[model samples]
Target chain A: MFLSFCDGNGSALGWAVLITVVLGVAGCAKNYVVLLPNDDGTTGKVAVAGREGVTLLEKGREGAAIGGPAGKTFMVSDEQIAEDFGAALAASPQKPVSYLLYFKAGTDVLTPESQADLPEILAEIQRRPAPDISVIGHTDTMGDAAENARLGLVRARSTAETISQLGGSIISPDRISIESHGEKNLRVSTPDNTDEPRNRRVEVTVR
Target chain B: MLAMRLLVLAGAFSLVVNVSSAEDAVIGYVKTVDGDAVVLVAGKATQAEPGTPLQRGNVLKTGKPGSMGVTLKDNTVMSLGPDTELVVDEYLYSPSDGDLKLGASMRRGSLNYISGVIAKLKPEGVSLKTPAGNIGIRGTHFLVTVEAKD
Candidate 1:
């Protein structure tokens, strides 16, 4: 009986030692940052400035403790990531989408093709929950700066009105914001008095 | 002459108000909420819901089972997991004037961040502060989890 008791105690100590080692290695630090690939499958770098030093993360799934010793990183497994960030990832909102609606030169009227694209914008607006949009108008450098500013505002306002009219009850009027970038923001850079068709457009971003 | 002077003074006052109000305009909106969350503006807590407008200096907090997502005017996307607290300390998005910035702080909890126009235009202007350290984003998607201090 004395020998059996001693054997049982030894086994228990071995199991405890194994469990402690596993836990120490697996749960080293709870505070850390992970780099994720962009929707396009391209990865970017992140610099974490910690107390000891800075660590740069460039590859997907590469992670480092926020309070780091620079250059120290580990690969986070998919299971661990899901357990840690499932809620936050699941709660991410839909990414915003932008559309460029071309306008007739010197007017707020949409081009024939742009007019047909209005339905698509309306569809997107209806698809989102509590959606908001911004209509920013841009003008070519063909006119005076002040005049272009006014024209840009006109285009933005008219485009917003069209979206509201088509969306009806799907979106509230207060949710649509209008701004005018005028000749300052040009899609295609050109000298003054140059007529660039691409520059004369309104950008609508649905979020 | 006295009436004209008073009118001028009133015009100046209104102009100042207009400029200040423009600065305090809504910078983003709460796009998604699950479970329980609140947005604290000027220290006053309001239950967060879809369409809730978020201004600068707002603190977003979530309960144990809560989650929230927000999309800023510049298209930056952020989501917070349960028991999380984040503050939008500063935001300046005026691309026409070449002014762009986004500064935020995460006191504790998990966050999912996706870069936006501001990051693309001015990469150095964006920073996320955590208790452990500061994160300098170079226009990418990332996840952060800050454990609560005992």
Candidate 2:
């Protein structure tokens, strides 16, 4: 009877230890929810109290800071999670890069250095899948606004033609668009009729 | 009875874990794509195109020569320049209820942002995160750029 009692006590102790471990794990892992708490608080700041730390949040604003352990579990508010926060966690689109190919004075011809950069730009466009191209022309303030506009378009058209010839594999005619900003949008701002080499260029946006 | 209680506790714990990691929700759609842009969500890359519904937690990445324009539900127009990485992070907007929150993070590249209803209603509610520091939106139109880290 004594041996049986000892065996029974040992089993009970083992069960208690298992239960404690499970309970402890749950306590440590309880996830906390973020509370916006105030709707009229757009001008007002809301405090997000989390295990990581407290973050003071304002309206029309977003951040990628840690609200919790993984820095991901931010919005679990009173059984109504802020789904928009999840979208914030998701990847947005990448930014587009542009290359400016300078042109010769009063002509649509590309400068030697700018011509050299054409292959590099083409390679950049070819690296992507079905890229879109925007060819915008600009000129120095040396000419009249109306004439500069026409010249810009001519420059853009010439660049487009070159891109078409060189970009056989990737450049579909429909994917390319040409525009002339002319002297209206100056790369280097100067007085009217001022000639600037930097401003006489074609800006190509390859995305 | 003890066994039943233990089982209940374990079940409850599992449920909490599942709820905390719920799937991301869609917030807006891609209005335009100039080149090669993609939205990275759940480890999968989705080509960004017109009418591509954007979700919270989506990471936007552009290729070497890519650009993307996005319109949010509240009419917030954002144009992203190439080689950019942006995350929506969090956005909560309900005008009638007066619950407005917008948050985003730009890891690299340039973003041209025009204020939407959220910013108009409460300018202080909008915040943008960058490598330099946090940007609090007071004006309606602005541009932000985060260059690539060496």
Candidate 3:
């Protein structure tokens, strides 16, 4: 009887531990759904949220700073799951990087140096895992804001066209927004000397 | 007695005005596509169940799946893609009364939009929200797709 009692207790303890180990293995190996309280993309693994899946973005509006959604994760519902996935997949928000390239004078064409730098901008775009880009043009205190915006747009478009035709990697024109600040963001803010050569170039940024 | 009569008159007038001012609902789903103006809420077949009341669209389906060729009352065209979900959260018409507003949220997939009157009211009036961020628009046409970010 004494031996039997001891054996029974040992068996019970071993079974409990064995069950725990099995569960641990399953939890660690398989991606499963663990219901979360919030709507953010916490819908567990393989579960898709339907209702709260979409996120809206307006012009000048920044969305949630979502890092890459790698590894197993969870979401609350199908909708939230979708939204989180969309965000995870969306391109990084790139703040336009402005560079003032000074031309010799009032010329629509880009000089050799400026042309060379174009490759650098294209290279930057290629660097990101998936980079978003935009180009805003600027001019010296030489033309009207409306005309400058138009000219700047044209310049930006021409440069973008060249990049597209490079045939290395195709960048969609729609993805690139080209506009002119019309010297609003000047490279140099000399009170008397508003017109600077540095202000006549294009700015490129990748996110 | 005279004062009570005047109060009742004012109350009646207020009630009548309130009844007149209730806003109506205008909502629809993509019915079919016909080039520019996509159909919304298929009037298909012999259902003859009238149709979904039209509302000032915050988002419309056009030349896209789910809601292929849906048009808004404002004449704005929304082109949506397969497996994509869009919601017109809030929309208002009549600028003088108040600015006509349009708001949309995308759950998945891709979409394209062409603005009409509401956008005309405010140049930067349209807003598209994705998980990554919000897209602010002012007087231009654009398209967007949802993809995994690295």
Candidate 4:
């Protein structure tokens, strides 16, 4: 039985033993990573930087890299983005601030007509440093009822989104909540068929 | 009968129709409405003076970085967002295609576009130029602001 074990060519057997021992020593026992060499003459796994295993979490275009060989994780979150999205929804509800501001029929464009009083609106929003600005848009009985309602909401949200883009840090978009009245909630009611421009508007309520 | 016919023409609300729909140019949606304008108090209008009548086809035309604005004929105004550029290819007062066209580009800065009758049309007629490309209008409007890249 012992001769059978040594029956192989002595030189070949020696080399095999050496290779087996080297492989056993090189490979990790468990829960560990080992570097291996590559063929093309360039060191591959030996010089390669890699994670044995990892997991990643992504939000929007952002991602959080974690659960790898290293305990530290890579994460990216912009305070500006957080604040922008948190704009007004985070606040307690309230009434309209003023009437100087107006909303376009289907868009969030700030009209030049309000240029006379925009400074006040800016000032008001500026004062609420951390205040969440909720811009709610509404439409009267002018256009299609369903379309108007949807426009009300879209206008509100667009306004908030615009504010976030034009931010002087007045209000973050994340902290903002854009809402729509859609003729449902009216500051001035025009029950049956009244096409009053005053009924279609956008309001920036501070929290 | 002739006098009444003239009066009817004067009081008639003309329907708006799409013009040059095939043109590469497209208008953008109104982002906000101040009094009647979209964007306000940007670099471009500052040059036009405080009370300058901002017209629809008038280009903001700023040599400096982040400067642009537009005033619709209806008195609606809009400021350009950063890094954006557009041109008023065509516009129509009667809702007919090709009546009037306004286009501008925001090379860099935030843009504030306001709605007039144009946005009400809701179509490819209004397109917001963006860094990634153009944003088609679906009636919903907004002020687009982009960062100026060196």
Q: Write the per-residue lDDT of candidate 2 for residues A101-139, one digit (tens) a residue.
A: 999899999999999999998998787544566788999
Number of the predicted model whose TM-score against the real structure is largest:
1
Candidate 4 per-residue lDDT over residues A125-158, each given as its tens digit: 6654234445667777766778877878877777
lDDT of 1 by residue, A17-38 (tens): 5554776533345578999999
Instruction: Give fnat of each prediction, in order.
Output: 0.87, 0.00, 0.01, 0.00
- Model 1 chain A: ten consecutive residues of lowest lDDT: A1-10
Q: Per-candidate interface C-alpha RMSD?
A: 0.8, 13.8, 16.1, 21.7
Give the clashing pairs for model 1: none
Highest DockQ scorer? 1
What is the Cα-based lDDT of residue B117 in candidate 4? 45
Q: Which residue ranges in model 3 land beyond 4 Å of their true spot?
A: A1-102, A111-113, A126-133, A143-147, A167-169, A172-176, A190-193, B1-150
Model 2 C-alpha lDDT per residue in residues B69-135, reported as the tens digit of each score = 7766555667776778899888886653577878998887666665566887877788877664565
What is the descending TM-score order? 1, 2, 3, 4
Residue-wise C-alpha lDDT for candidate 3, range A5-63, written one tens digit per residue: 21224555556456546654221211111222212322111111223352222222122
Q: Chain A only: list TM-scores of all candidates.
A: 0.87, 0.59, 0.48, 0.46
B102 in model 2: Cα distance from truth in Å? 15
Q: What lDDT tens digits, residue by residue, belong to model 1 across residues B1-150?
A: 999999999999999998778658899999999998999988899999999999888899999999999999999999999999999888999998898999999999999999999999998999999987899999999999987775
- Model 4: share of native contacts present? 0.00
Candidate closer to the true structure by TM-score (higher is better), 1 or 3: 1
